[model samples]
Target: MSVSLMDFHADWCGPCKTQDPILDELKNDWGDRFDLEKVNVDEEQDVANEYQVRSLPTLIVENDDGVVERFVGVTQREDIEDALERAGA
Candidate 1:
């Protein structure tokens, strides 16, 4: 069972900029314990639509069991870490 963090963002989004580094740090710190998938909404519209992401910086946390949480806007590191913990990352 593996956990994944799907980050839906665009190049022109300001809040997404704030969200990126936090996710990057988590990806580096957690290593193989979790997977981080960065989705560029401008390029991957289908993926963004499939997730029904209407805004920038949508973070979807999922595991083998399925989605654990979905966050929009500039999410805090603690909240994301908590979701990862719940997803058994």
Candidate 2:
């Protein structure tokens, strides 16, 4: 099965910068299993607000099946793997 990974971040946010590498690692490792999209809060406020992301580095792992998990803050890479596994990736 396939999943949708949405990352909400802003350019000026420090946490967003810190989380970028982690997300890059995740993408390189899991790209084949999921469709990853990065949405900037500044440019994609509609999407960000819809997801109720109050933080800079928010991650939403969803599918056409709907969101399986919503993570707020700088998530650990292993935790992300766990979420993917729980989502049946």
Candidate 3:
């Protein structure tokens, strides 16, 4: 089962800017180990609401089983990797 990282962010969010690069680096480094999906809250309001994303840079880590972790605000790369590991990515 592939792990997915759903990044809920908006263009005007400063913290999301900071979080983007970290997730990009991980996506480059990991390469096919997991799926990284960026959800622009402005454009994807329904998806954001479904996930109950109330903050910028919310990282939702999930796999076939279900959601493994949900993090709000800027998150550390290590923490995200830990969540991926937990999801058996």
Reference-based TM-score of each model? 0.96, 0.91, 0.98
lDDT of each: 0.94, 0.85, 0.95
Which predicted model would earn the best lDDT?
3
For model 1, how does the per-residue alpha-carbon lDDT over 1-89 read when each residue is reduced to its tens digit?
79999999999999999998899898888899999999999999999999999988899999999999999999998999999999998
| Poorest lDDT segment (10 consecutive residues) of candidate 3 | 48-57
Per-residue lDDT of model 3, residues 1-42, tens digit only: 989999999999999999999999999999999999999999
TM-score of predicted structure 3 = 0.98
Scanning candidate 1 in windows of ten residues, the lowest lDDT window is 21-30
Positional deviation of residue 16's Cα in model 1 after best superposition, in angstroms: 0.6
Error of 1 at 57 (Å): 1.0
Name the TM-score of candidate 2. 0.91
State how far residue 14 of model 2 sits from its true place (Å): 0.4
What ordering of candidates by TM-score runs from best to worst?
3, 1, 2
Writing each residue's lDDT as its tens digit, candidate 2 over 1-89 gives 77877889988989888888998888898778877789999998998889898987999988667889989888899988888777777
Candidate 3 local lDDT, residue 23: 97
